[model samples]
Structures are given as C-alpha cells and as structure tokens.
Target: MRRAISVGRDQLMSVGVCFGKFTKSGKFKLHITALDYLAQYAKFKLWIKPNGEMQFLYGNHIAKAHVGRISEDVPEHQGIVIFSMADVPLGFGVTARSTVDIRKLQPTDIVVFHQADVGEYLREQDTLF
Candidate 1:
C-alpha cells in the first residue's frame, strides 16, 4: 500500500507480503530487494567500499571512511539510500549526520545509516518464501 504511495505506482499483484514500517519522512522502509528498487528514483544515496560490504550485510554500521559517495544535498534527518560500490542499494535508513559532518570525520569513525537489527526479519522472509 505504501510503496504505491511513495513511488506512485499501485499495480501490485502479489498475494502476500512482508513489509516493514515507514520512516518519519513518510518513506516506506524495507530491506533486501526493495533497496534495489528504490535506488531507481531515490535522490539521496550513499555507497560503501567492498571492505564494508560484509559487515553491512551482517547488519553493522557503515563508518565514514568506508563510505564512498553520498548525496551532498541530503540533510541529517532525511532518508538515504545505502548502495554498494557496484551501485546496488543495500538498505534504507535516516541519516544521523549531514554530508558536511560526514566529510570531517575520521576513517574509523561511525558516519550513519544504522542498519536495522532485522535478523529475525530476514529469517522470516526466508521461511515465508
């Protein structure tokens, strides 16, 4: 229902779904394939290096140094699309830091994108399919 509103398309034909909640900004948030789908139109995007990919997949925070590129105009609270070096959206999250602040941080310092602790969510999706 929300995806139709966010992206403005509502021809969904799925029989069942396992969706998460929405960000305060009113963007519907989900993990996995939705990231790739949203990447098509979402303006705010950030990418991480290969080194950070493993930890990111395991649901770890992406550090400042690991981040490759992020939209400069994105503010601190807006939702951002987290992508890979290969340009694949990895997940979604509200930005905890602005672009300028992220630029001044040290390599190991945490930047943002608090990947949700969705271990059970992923496990549930696996079983549902």
Candidate 2:
C-alpha cells in the first residue's frame, strides 16, 4: 500500500517561482514566465510576420523586412515584446532602432535582438521540471 502526498499553496509559495533576478551588475534578467506576464503590459511591441515568428521561435533576431507593425514610440535599445500578427505572445527582445531611426534602416537590418522565446519552455523542459 502507498500513500499519496499533497502540498498546499503555502508550501508552493515557500519554494517560490523564479520569475527573474538581478545580476551582479544590477541588471534585471527576466525568466520566460516573467516575460509572459509582462508582455500584456509592455509599452513597446513588435508584431511580426509568419516568417519572422518562425525564425524568432528558433532563437533568431528579427529583421526589418519581417516586421508587420511596430508600436508608435519604441526607443532604441528598449526591451519590447514580440508577437505574431495574430496576437500571440512569442518572445521578447531589445529594439535595434528607435521609431525614428528604424525609418532609415535597410530591409535586412536587424530590428530586434532575441532575448527569450516561448520555445524555451519545451527546449528546457527537463531542467524546468
């Protein structure tokens, strides 16, 4: 015979979820879960085309040609959430150009540098669980 064990919400809270952490240099590093929560409230966002969505899921940066739309005032080097044109949250990255600067960018120029992506959940499942 065996007994099943159950943990309470307080127990889970004690273990704590690793949302993010501040680095030695004081920069905050966000985990994928945190990115998902923050995506909805993010001021800057990039809605990318299907091709870009696939590339982004593969951990690649976004190029200008693949951008479907951009939020009005995204500044250069600002952290922004990436989304599919259909409005699914995909990942997050830092903008390579500001709204004004991007206007002068070439089609192939990098628009966003990949930080973290939803694919990481599957790719890092072993470590997560």
The top-ranked prediction according to lDDT is 2
1-129 in candidate 1: lDDT tens per residue? 555555534655453343455779999656454554566889888888898876776777778877888887778877777778897666766787888888778888877666443343565566433
- State the weakest 10-residue window (summed lDDT) of model 2: 1-10
TM-score of each: 0.67, 0.81
The per-residue C-alpha lDDT of model 1 at residue 13 equals 47
lDDT of 1: 0.70
lDDT of 2 by residue, 1-129 (tens): 012126655554334457766879999888787766778799998999997788899889999999999999888899999989999899899998998888899999999999989998988766543
> Backbone clash tally for model 2?
0
